[model samples]
Target: MSRRLITEVAGVIEAPVERVWPEIVRTVPRTELGEHVLAYQGGWWYRGEWSVTPVPGGTRLVHRVYDVAGQGWAVALANRLFIGFRERTRRSFAEGLVHLGNRLGCATRLT
Candidate 1:
C-alpha cells in the first residue's frame, strides 16, 4: 500500500514575481526550502513536492508531503501512529508564508 499526505495553503502577494521569488527562497523555512523550476517553486520530499506558482501580482505556494511504506500492517500502524500530521504541516506552511509577507512588506490573501 502507498500512503501519502498532502496539504496546501496559497496566497497572493502584492509584489511582482521578481521580488516574490527571492523572498520565498530566502524566507521560507529550511525544512520547506525548495527551488524554482520555470513558474513553479518546489522541494523534494520523501515522495512529493511542495510546489509554488507565480501569479500575476505575486506567487502561490503549496506544501505537500508523501509518506510511503510498502504493504500491510506496517503502513496501517504508521498511519494510525501519526495524528494531527496534516494540521501541523498546514499550519507550518501557512505561518511561514504569513511571516514572509510581513517581512517583505507585502499584502497577501489565502486563495
Candidate 2:
C-alpha cells in the first residue's frame, strides 16, 4: 500500500500585501493549475503548492508538498532515507524566502 506524505512551511514577509503579492506572483516558480492556485512539479509523483495570504503588516506565504500513490511513496522514502529530503527542502525554502525578501527590499520572518 502507498502512504501519503505532506509537508508545510510558512514565512511572513515584512511588506504590505500590495508589494508582496506581485513579487510572489512573479517570482514563485509554479504552474498555473487553476485560478489563484500555483503548483510546483516535484520529483516523480511529488507535487507542491505556493499559497500567499495577506496579513495585517505583511503577507504570509505557505508552501506545501504532497506525495501520494505508489510512486510517490517510493520516491518519498528514497529521498528521506538516502538524500535527507527534509533538511534539503527546508534549506531551499529558506534561501528562496531570503531571495524574496531581497527582491521586495524588506525582511522575511520564517514561522
Q: TM-score of the candidate numbered 2?
A: 0.75
lDDT for each residue of candidate 2 in 1-111, tens digit (9 for 90 to 100): 243556778899988767776776787677876544587775665677887777877888888777644663465566665366666777788899999999888999888
- For each candidate in the order shown, give its overall lDDT on alpha carbons: 0.60, 0.75
Candidate RMSDs in Å, in order, are 5.2, 3.4
Clashes of 1: 0
Which tens-of-lDDT digit does each residue in 1-111 have in candidate 1? 364554445567676667777766664444443355222223322443445677777777655565554343465566575577677766776777677788879887766
Q: What's the C-alpha lDDT at position 71 in model 2?
A: 60
Runs with alpha carbons beyond 4 Å of true place in candidate 1: 1-5, 28-48, 68-73
